[model samples]
Target: MLMLPAMARSSCERVIVSADPAYPPLHWYDGKQLRGASIVIITRILTDLGLPYELRYLGPWKRVLYAAKNGNIDVITTLKITPERRSFLIFSELVLNNPVAAFVKKDRPPPFSKWDDLIGLRGGIARGNRFGSVFDEFMDERLNVREADNLETAFNMLLANRFEYVITGYHVGQAYIASANIDDKLIALQPFLIDSQNLFGFAAQSPCIAYLPAINKQLEKLHKEGFIERALAQARADWRKTPIIGKN
Candidate 1:
């Protein structure tokens, strides 16, 4: 792990971090505590740097984004970069590369060869997510998009045949399917929509913004040393042992 210079590190003490409580295997509320790969990795990084910090399980995914945007929260553990979000947050280097894919009922899979194939299909997406700049723009202008408050709701809607497909992070969708025991009923389409990098970002108006350089440096080191990979592997194992139920 890379160590920040003492002065730079000191400024980051007592930082406040927040993430969606339901995004599991990456981050989630385990009834009493916030737990997941990102949470565990980030906590270790902060501890190793001797920076005291607070982790918060804010309301929903949208609420977490709202808090981070207004500087009510210091850091957000995982988010995809977009022009709108860039207005309120300064992002760190890539923390995890999340592949975005579409889920469909096994009986009625769509002909999904490329991005353009999704244009006319009815699809569900989480309310505040941005798959990538290209897909976001496409959704805005062309796709038949339906927004849901969370992934579980979106998946439920898809299962009920309310929509033809639901787009989500590949691993997250897989975990949700296994947890909900819907793998036999649904399938993820081939050729991901995009590979999005999950990042740690500070609110633009945050006091912790000054420490972003140091944070990025440490994050890069962690990524290089396989700390993040190890944490993710462990989290995947844990998720398999006890799959998480999707919130209704």
Candidate 2:
């Protein structure tokens, strides 16, 4: 683990946490509040640390990030570490591996075996989504990908032929396919675009930043104990029982 810089203790009353409501099995909005493995893990860590925390349902994924950028939210339970995100947040230890994939219409799966194959294609991705710094830079400089407000809309547009593909988390795409009963319509291409790590991020300007080192230590303990695996399995089952509401 990398050592974090020393910082003054926080006078923060409670940690405010939020995540993409549209992302599932990891974290998602269940209409009323956030749910899934990320929530289960982070809240448990806070409790163990004897810290008060609030899991705010701040609408869309983009808004949740905006709140974090402005220090309105102290922690984001799960997100890939990207260069732009690092500007406003300090990330914790690796929480889990999040593999990103390109979803194409079943009948038109691209001849994609490498990143270079995607250059001329039109792709769709949800707003505030990032695969990694490399792919993000590639997308900006070489690919033609558009952003939709959320995954549901991006998938819908893909189905409507508005775009050739939609790039998102492989598991998230699968969950959406099952929930929407569109299993026959879309498929995630093999050889994932990128496999990224999901980590808890504390806002750089939030008083909660003081707890990052402690949080990282706890996260390391959880990973070694395999608690995160159990939580994810439980979260997947819970997600199936709840209805997935579309975000605006």
Candidate 3:
């Protein structure tokens, strides 16, 4: 862990990176603080770039986006820029473009494909997630949708069979499923819907507009050096454990 002296806190201000407590591998509240791959990567970028930044706790997506758009907050992590968001904040070059998938308890239902596949399958989604324009627009009436205030709640709901399906970035789904040790309970299904990878970067057009390009430079540098991959590999290694389910 890194630490700064007491005097440094008053002398220099770390730009605030606003985070909502969802979207694992990007931003979420760990037991101690905001953490996940994107959080770690952003921290690494700032340290490597010699920039000072702090993670700010934002309650939900709406308030955080409001703060970001108004420049009340300096940055936001892992935003998928639509035209509306583009107007409010500048966007950095994407860090990781991860695929999204439908996850459900294995054996309960057949797989889903196409937009209408969600019919009759009560789907739980993290509120305010950008699942691409096509799916985003369709999420309203096309699917029987249940919104969870947070990822853990969504998973808990799914675990209880409250919803037939839940969707998330593929790797995050895998990590959480592993964390729950619920191999028989939840399985990431086939025909991953939606395209374009979920990318992490500084909020571009917002208050941090002047700062993102530099972070992008650092991200590119990290990519070239394979530092990002190495970092993620080390992170996953730290959390490896036997499945909490199915072993018995």
Candidate 4:
């Protein structure tokens, strides 16, 4: 493991990004620069592949999706592809399968046991996040879905009862509930149905696909080296020790 020097920072070819300060374990702002699990994984993959690139770090998820869709960005890390999006982007092999579910205040009756159940309920979800094309397409128009600026805010809204529920990753749900000192008020219920999801290397076409295969290659390497499990376990441990501050 070598540290990148000042001369190394400007070396890569441009890889488009929109990693604002919101997403965690995937992307984050360290009060100085963008860094996180996805960034670490992406950096290791690109560096190992000898691919030089720059990150755009767009502030909104919608913008990130738009950039990837329009060829404004070469690739977006940790995106799940669905049938509807396949027409616009190519995906690398699965980086990860994130579990998704409805997070609600504690002691509440289960409002969801199926995708169709969420359709009639008013809920919040981060814009551009998808469960699957079928679910995403339905979410696009059928549900009374409110768009939150980010996952934490969505959890905030849920706690405030601004919405009936919030659709998001189980990790995010757990983190937010713990971080906000709201575990007593919120609980993730019935994973209901599981989506065989993948955080794909989203590319506009072949040239970019050339770069993405390297990420899968590195992921395979990391898997064999036990890096993935250890990193995730570390993240969970760190998150658990960090206490909730204001919302207590």
On TM-score, the leading prediction is 2
Candidate scoring better on lDDT of 1 and 3? 1
lDDT of 4: 0.64
Root mean square deviation (Cα) for candidate 4: 6.1
> Per-model C-alpha lDDT, please?
0.80, 0.86, 0.67, 0.64
TM-scores, all models, native as reference: 0.89, 0.90, 0.79, 0.77
lDDT for model 1, on a 0 to 1 scale?
0.80
Candidate 4, residues 1-248: lDDT per residue as tens digits? 75332223332355554443455555555444555556666666777877776766665667666656665566666666677568767776666556777887786645666777776677998756678766667777788988887777887888787888898877656765665678788887686445545565454542546566667888889778877656655555555564322110
Which window of ten consecutive residues has the lowest lDDT sum in model 3?
239-248
List runs of model 4 lying over 4 Å from the truth.
1-21, 116-120, 140-142, 236-248
Task: List RMSD in Å for every model shown.
Answer: 5.3, 5.1, 6.3, 6.1
Using lDDT, give the best candidate's number: 2
Q: Candidate 4, 111: how far from true, in Å?
A: 5.9
TM-score ranking, high to low: 2, 1, 3, 4
lDDT of 3 at 162: 90
Candidate 2 global TM-score: 0.90
Off by over 4 Å in 3: 1-13, 200-207, 237-248
59: Cα error in model 2, Å:
1.9
Winner of 2 and 3 under TM-score: 2
Worst 10 residues of 2 by lDDT: 2-11
